[model samples]
Target chain A: MGELVVDELEVQKYQEQEVEENGLPLVLLYGPLSLLNVFGSESLLNNFRLIKPWESPEIPLHEYLITHAKNVKALVCLGKTELDSKAIHCLPSLEIVVTCAAGLNHIDLIECRRRGIMVCNAGNAYTIDGADYAVGLLLDVLRRVTSGDRYVRSRMWPLKGEYRLGSKLRGKRVGIVGLGSIGSEVVKRLVPFGCKISYNSRKKKPGVPYPYYSSVYDLAVNNDVLVLLCSLSEETFHCIDKDVLTALGKDGVIINIGRGPLVDEEQLVRFLVNGDIAGAGLDVFEDEPAVPRELMELDNVVLSPHKAVFTPESFIELQELIVGNLQAFFSKKPLLSLYKNALSASS
Target chain B: MGELVVDELEVQKYQEQEVEENGLPLVLLYGPLSLLNVFGSESLLNNFRLIKPWESPEIPLHEYLITHAKNVKALVCLGKTELDSKAIHCLPSLEIVVTCAAGLNHIDLIECRRRGIMVCNAGNAYTIDGADYAVGLLLDVLRRVTSGDRYVRSRMWPLKGEYRLGSKLRGKRVGIVGLGSIGSEVVKRLVPFGCKISYNSRKKKPGVPYPYYSSVYDLAVNNDVLVLLCSLSEETFHCIDKDVLTALGKDGVIINIGRGPLVDEEQLVRFLVNGDIAGAGLDVFEDEPAVPRELMELDNVVLSPHKAVFTPESFIELQELIVGNLQAFFSKKPLLSLYKNALSASS
Candidate 1:
């Protein structure tokens, strides 16, 4: 007994079983219904015990979370999942939350701060793709790419006549809302298209050459196109209201790749319908999966399911970052994409 | 007799009437069926006795041109109308042809040269808009902007869950077919999007830094995207055929803002239908508005009705150039935007 000399095969089998069941850390895979299956989450499964509460159809996510996922030390949240105080309280032992998204509006920073839990985001993974989508939306709306597609699809060109001419993108006065990583990239991309780039952020981005407007209204008043790339905060909520829309005027277009709530969707729809604004290219909605019905037939408004950061490249980058950040967290090494503002606030 | 006459009001009335009827140098508006009404041609009407054969509808264009337009000294052509030898023969006094388009494929350069007919095109008016459209199509195809619009329009997003993730536009290797003004602008636009640009012009463009592949096949082999910006000619007609498409491979996309026959339409349809290549964004087709029926159901292809260079800004610029060039020709001044290649070859 002291030397443990007997039945090494049985001992090895027992140890292997133990390691298989409990050796790796657990992570709550929180996202859309199809999240765990799609998005190449198998790599995460290889290293962590991934428990998706929504996978079990019989029980609801919150109940399942409280019952079975209490001990999970980490949560891997995807885009737009509400990770508030009540949800955080369900997982009592949760030490870190890693979001596979650029936006963190769903995460409760105050609650997470009070509990002293760490947070990680997708970092620069979304920056390039987000910027690309923003510009793509702007181009699509300006050139009527989507409308032209619809007209062609309906066989309208031959039957009726040529599709109406769209306004040019070159030399457009573009105002970027939020000169963050993604917004900066948007400015860069639009620059070579001959667009005059300016921006509105919470504060002046030091050393940036693009003209900066202090308020969203001032930005809207000056620009022919307002690209909404700012995050949704209390101050930023419904920031693109009727005042901003009116300021943007009849010829101006709005491109929203940020959170839906960042825009006043109802007002936007009314503006778009009444021709108060020229058009909109929206990737996110006020209530996702519930786009305004009026937008269905609009040639000007190009609606997209929130897919700005959902490119294959971004997903791969985010997956790697999630793994890297989690590994770093477990090793007590510096987390790759730690939300340092939140961490520093709590500290 | 008029100098000796004392009736000044009657003389002025006769003079105004004569000017209205035939005094202004006649210009045959050679274009599509509805071209006279669209495209801000009212300004053109003010400058010259603009005669439209298609507008009358009493006789066929050929017959109308023979009877009514034989005395016309200048012709203003719109896009894609066949101004070949046969059409040119009808207008015996056709000293010059001004096409309100970037492409001059329908103008029959060889025939025009043989007949001593000068031709002018839209000049740099199409350059900015053409580049904008090429990049727009590339972005739309890569980001599935048109497809996303369709999906949302079809109400498939909520029903079908999430739209599939597209590949990133960042870091794509792009091959531009022609390195003219528009193609050069396309390079400038795609640079900040992180695309690696190369080209296959007739010869290597001087002082350019991008890699130049002399052959289309080689260009297709190395690039993720092939943008057809070359004018359609004997050499470039059906240039993107089976070999070129195959070389482009399954992941490569084609954005054709050039003339229709620049690509072999039948082979492209087959490649797209069979998934031999990724996708295409086609503004022009082999036949004037008769898009392949097969492409109607495909999400991979985005079809446009040759409106790439038809933005409002371009129209105003083109209208001015059209009038300016005609005035210059009449005044024995150097023609603006003259197709010097065709002129030089003829001389």
Candidate 2:
């Protein structure tokens, strides 16, 4: 019996050494899609042994999570993953959750708070790229850049004369719906173009020199362009509806870089079709990966997939931030990018 | 005999009263396209009686010019019109020529100079719009804004996975080929986006903050993106050739908002096809209205129909400037937007 016990202990020690050759912490990455290692960050792989459960499509997700539950102290969630109470219960040893995206809509923040599971996100990592994209979409719509590209590609310029003139951006009143990181960056870019900036947010930020509006309708009424960059929550869902579109009027243009549900997309299509509103530059949709068919033919509207934050520079920054957060969490140091004041619960 | 003389005097007085009813100058407008009266600028009509040769297509152009030669003191030249030596000779009484376009390439400046005819262009009217369009094209190319728009419009998002990531604009080293009005405006707008700007112009602009490169090769080697916003002349034609493209390397992008001949179109097409360069955003082509069919299929290139300066606000401003120049000419004041030191002949 003593000889058998000694043999078992030696076998266990060898297995531990094989699994953690570099002595890095073991982190279980659970998500429907496996994107944690796609960037191939050397520092991340050198620091932690990321166990991606979704890599083996044959294995059931629950079984995989249970297999690593005892040793896994951290979970890395991708954008599409949902961390409900059941998933949280399965990860009994999980002390922290790290998301590689800015939005936390997929994560059950309430459950995380209840369980005291610290969460870190890619905070301000996507802000500049997202803001730059919003401006690009707006310029594409107002100046017909995409439509012009199509016309040239279709071999129509030779047949047609000069293209029809587009609207100008200088001196136009631009009302930003959100004054967060992305929206504030948008304001900074537009200022140099001579665009008049205004805003309407959850609460008036003190000392912001831009004119503040109490409501979206009021903001639309006075501005030539309305740019949506606010967060997605219950109170903000469909915040840009038919009434706001009607108030925006025929000469008004709207740009939505935020989540799609923030605007009543169906009404927006109707307004665009009827020529009630001048134009729109949309980067997000109500049902993403599925935009309205009516928008495809409209020359006045510019459509883009939800790729406002997908840039190589931004991805590099995000990878660095993610690596930093994980290292900090394991060391019991302050989380690098913990989104404080979780207001969506109240919203 | 006395009664006959008195009857002739009454006839002359009636003709004088009819001509002076508006008290406006008689300005001869010669072009295949009639665009002067289209804007319906009452101020222009109140200031001068514009004689449009293209209005009566049935009449010969020479006959029309000869008919109005004696009374015409000013001439308005549109884009398609060729005011060569012969045309200038026909209008012996022409004192001033007004073109509502930024480029005066269509006009025979040598002939005008020989005749001592003052020429006024659209000047800074198109500066703001042109700069905005250049920035828009750069953004579209670097961020894949137009391609993403097409991806959504083609209904490829649902079928395909996430679109490929794009290069970010932040921290990019941009090289402006010409630091004139439009290029300067582009530098101003790009500053807020964290782009480091440099330039290569006719001469190093005194007191300009941007670093100046004496040669295009040096500029291409150092910068990540090269923008062509210089005037197209003999010296500048095909300036961005194979050598410059090679130096720009595989990761560089080129934006041409200037005349198309500024860059070698064939070399550009080859470079783009072979991936020698990352991408290109071209608004003007070597031949207007006739873009290379090869460029149509390339996903990295953004094409426009030479519409960089085409905007309603800019057109409105151009109309006002044209009127102001004509008024200033008639009143014998300094020309508002004259092209001093016309150097295309030497170029």
DockQ for every model comes to 0.46, 0.45
Model 2 C-alpha lDDT per residue in residues B198-268, reported as the tens digit of each score: 99998999989989998888999999999999987778899999999999999999999989999999999
Tell me what TM-score chain A of model 1 achieves: 0.90
Give the Å shift of residue B289 in candidate 2.
Answer: 0.3
Candidate 2 residue A317 C-alpha distance from true site, Å? 0.9
Query: TM-score, each model?
Result: 0.90, 0.92
Report lDDT (Cα) of residue A113, candidate 1: 85
Residue-by-residue lDDT tens digits, candidate 2, A1-347: 00112233433332322144467887766664335434334566557766666656687777767765556778878665787877887777778888887777878888777777788888999999998998998888889999999988988888866677788999989999989999989999999899999999989999899999989999999998999998888888999999999999999999998889999999999999999999999988999888889999899998888888778788788888888888998788988998664323433
Clashing residue pairs, candidate 1? none
lDDT of each: 0.83, 0.82
Reference-based TM-score, model 1: 0.90
Error of 2 at A14 (Å): 14
> Candidate 1: which stretches are off by over 4 Å?
A1-23, A31-33, A51-71, B1-23, B51-72, B90-93
* DockQ for candidate 2: 0.45
Q: Find the candidate with the highest TM-score and give its number.
A: 2
